[model samples]
Target: MTSTAGYDVERIRSQFPILQRELKGKPLVYFDNAATSQKPQVVIDALVEYYSMYNANIHRGIHTLAEEATAAYEATREAVRAFIGAPSTEEIIFTRGTTEGINLVAYSWGRANILEGDEIIISSLEHHSNIVPWQMLAAEKGAVLKVIPINAHGEILLEEYYKLLNPRTKLVSVVHASNSLGVINPVKVIIDAAHAVGAVVMIDGAQSTVHLDINVQELDCDFFAFSGHKLYAPTGVGALYGKRELLEAMPPFHGGGEMIKEVRFDGTTYNDLPYKFEAGTPNIADTVAMKAALEFINGIGKENIRRHENDLLQYGTEQLRQIPGIQIKGDVAEKVSVISFVAEGIHPQDLGVLLDQQGIAVRTGSHCTMPLMQCLNITGTTRASFAAYNTKEEIDRLVAGLHKAIKILR
Candidate 1:
C-alpha cells in the first residue's frame, strides 16, 4: 500500500474494512475523523496477531513470548521516534492517550519546576484536555494560567502571546492543530518564542499527527503528545515525546512495576528515561498495533495524505459555504481538513442527529473545547473532519445531508 504521485483514494479506502459497512441501508459517510480515525485492516491484524501469537507481558520475562512482546513493544518506540523525527527512542514515553500524556507532564514536570507566581501560557483554541490539567497544576502550585487570545478566525494572537511571555512564564503548552476548528497552529513559531522567554513548550499533537508532517527536533518543542487512536490505531495507546534532559529531570509520573530499578522499605530508585514514566504492564497489544498504524501512514507518505486531505478541506469548505444559512467557523488560511459550521435557525445537536440518520457522521457540540466555544460566541458547531481515506464524494454526501437537515429543521 505505497502512496504514489497520483493518490489512489479508492484503493486507500478499500484498506479500511469499516468504511465498507452500511449504516441504515446507506453507505457510511464518516466525517467525524477529528474525534478518532477508523483503523486499517493491517492495524487490526497487528492487534489480533499480538494477542494470538505472543500474549505475554513485556520487559521482564526471559521466555520467548516475553522477548518477542518486548521487542515488538520497543519497536513501536523506535517507530514513533522516526515518525515524529525525535532524536532517540529514549525520548518517547507511552501513555494511555493525549489526555494522560498531558496529565503526566503536569504532575511530573509541572510539580517539579513550577513555583508560586509562575505562569503557564496556553491559547484560547485549546481542548479541555490541554486546559484542565494545567488548571489543576496551577491551582495546586499557586501558579497563574494565562491565555493568548484568538481573533474571530481562530488563530492565536502572536503579539498577545509575546506580551504574555516573561520571566514568570515557565511553560507554554498549546495544540499543534485545534480539534474544534481544524486550524493548524504555527507550533514552530510558538515553540521558538516560548524558548526565547525560557519557557518549556509542550505541543498537543493529537490532531496534527494525522494530517501534518511532524519533526520534533525541527520544531524544538520540549514536549509533544499525540494519541494512537487519532492516528488510526487502537484506543488507550499514545506517546509523549520529551527532551531527554527534561524527562530525566522530571519525577516519575506513576509508581509501580518496571519504573523501579531497585526498591526497599526505606528508599527506591527509579528506572531509566522512558520506563520511569511508563509504569506497570502497559497496553501491550495496542502499543504493538501502533507501529502498524505508523507504518500505514509511512507507506502512504505523509505528504501525499496531506495533499489529499487538503483537497477535501478546500472542496468541503467551498461547497458548505454555498448554503444560504451556513456560517463556517475557524476560517483560517492555514488549516487541516476540518470544517466547523452552524446552520442558521438550527441547533448543532439537531443538525448532527439529522445527519446521523442519513448515515453521515459528524461531531457536534463544543468538541471538548467549551472555552473555545465561548470564544466563538456559540454553543457548538457541527464539525466534518476528513482523513486520507475520505473522498470528495463523501464530502458531497455530507453537504447533501446538511441540506436535508436544514430542510427538515427550518
Candidate 2:
C-alpha cells in the first residue's frame, strides 16, 4: 500500500471511476486486464472534450473544428510512432483493432508477396488474431502455414523454429506475448532468424505493447499490431506499424474518400502512405482520446508499472500455489502479469462464474487461443491478468475466492 518510487497504486485506482463500482454485494476486483483495460478519468475527459468541443471529421475540412479534430487524431499517430519506436508516423496506420491490423497486412502485403507453396511461420503461443488472418491468406494464396512448436513450459523452441525456416519462407508472424499462457516469446531472435531465410516478420503486440518496452526498429520486425482498448483507451481504435519501404510497396488497404488523392471515373490515384490505408471516416473521437491513454501510461512510467505488476504476479503465484489440485498453464518464469491455471476436478467456466459472484472478475475459456488450449491438453483455463491500477489486496481477494470456489466445486 506504500508509494515507492512515486507510484501510488491507490492514487492510480482513484482515477478510474469504474473501479469504485461493485459487481455483486462486494467491492469489484477486475483482473481481466488482458481482455481489456479500464480507462482513467484523463482518457474519459479527452473523449468528452473531443465530442463536446471539436466533433468534426479529420483531414478534409480546413475549418476551426476540423483542424482541432484532425490535429488531435494525428497526434495519436505520432504517439504510437514514439511508443513503438517506428521510423515515422507515415508507417503507423490506424485500424479498428489488432485483428484489423493483421488482416490489413495479410490482405495488402501478403497478397502481393506470397506465392503458391511459399511458407508462413507462426507459433503455438499465438492468439487467434495472429493465426486466423494468415490461415485465410494461406488458403487463398496456396501457401503453406507452419507452426513453430513449444516446450512443456510453453516456451518457444528456437531450434524447432529454425528447422521451419527456409528460402521458401515468406513471412514469420507471431505474438510477442501469449494471452492465454502469459508467456513472452523471444521475438527479436525470431525476427533475425526469419530474416536470415529472406522473410519478413510481423509481431502481434496486442499483449506486449502495454507491458513490455517495444522498439520495432531495434527488433527489426517489418510490422507490429496492437489495440487501443487493451491500452486503456476506447474499443474501436488500434494501430498497425509497418516499415516505410514495405508499406509503400504494399497496395492501399481500402478504397474510398480520404484514402484517395484523386477520384476520377477512369481510374483513381491513392493518397500517400497512411491515408492510403485509412479509408472513409475514421474512429475520430476514440482515436483522439487514444493519445490521452498513451500519455496516461507514460505519466505513470512503464518500468515503474511493470515493477509493481511483477510484484503482484509473484505474490499471486505464491498464494495460488497453495490451493490443492491447481496447475498453472505455461508455468514459466518469463511472463507478464497474467496467470492462467486449470484445476484438477473443476471446469474453468465454473471457477470463473464462482469468482464473479464474489465480484472478482476474471476471463474464462480459451482466451481466443483454442489451438493453444488443445496443445495444453485442457478444455480451457481461468485467467486473471493484472494492470497498473491493480493491488496486492485484490490478488488476496482473488486467492480467497479461488479457495472458496475449489471447496464448493470439488
Pairs clashing within candidate 2 = none
lDDT by residue (tens digit), candidate 2, 1-410:
74346779999999999999989989899999999999999999999999899999889998999999999999999999999999899999999999999999999999999999999999998888899999999999999999998987789999999999999999999999999988999999999999999999999999999999999999999999999999999999999999999999999888888999898899999899899999999999999999999999999899999999888888888888888888888878889999999889889999999999999999999999998888878889999999999988998999899999988987
* Global lDDT scores for all candidate models: 0.93, 0.93
Worst 10 residues of 1 by lDDT: 1-10
Among the numbered candidates, top TM-score falls to 2
Which sections of candidate 2 miss by over 4 Å?
A: 2-5
Write down the lDDT that model 2 would get.
0.93
Kindly provide the TM-score of model 2 when superposed on the true structure, using C-alpha atoms: 0.99
Per-residue lDDT of candidate 1, residues 279-316 (tens digit): 89999999999999999999988888998888888888
| lDDT for residue 284 in candidate 1, whole number 0-100 | 95
TM-score of 1: 0.98
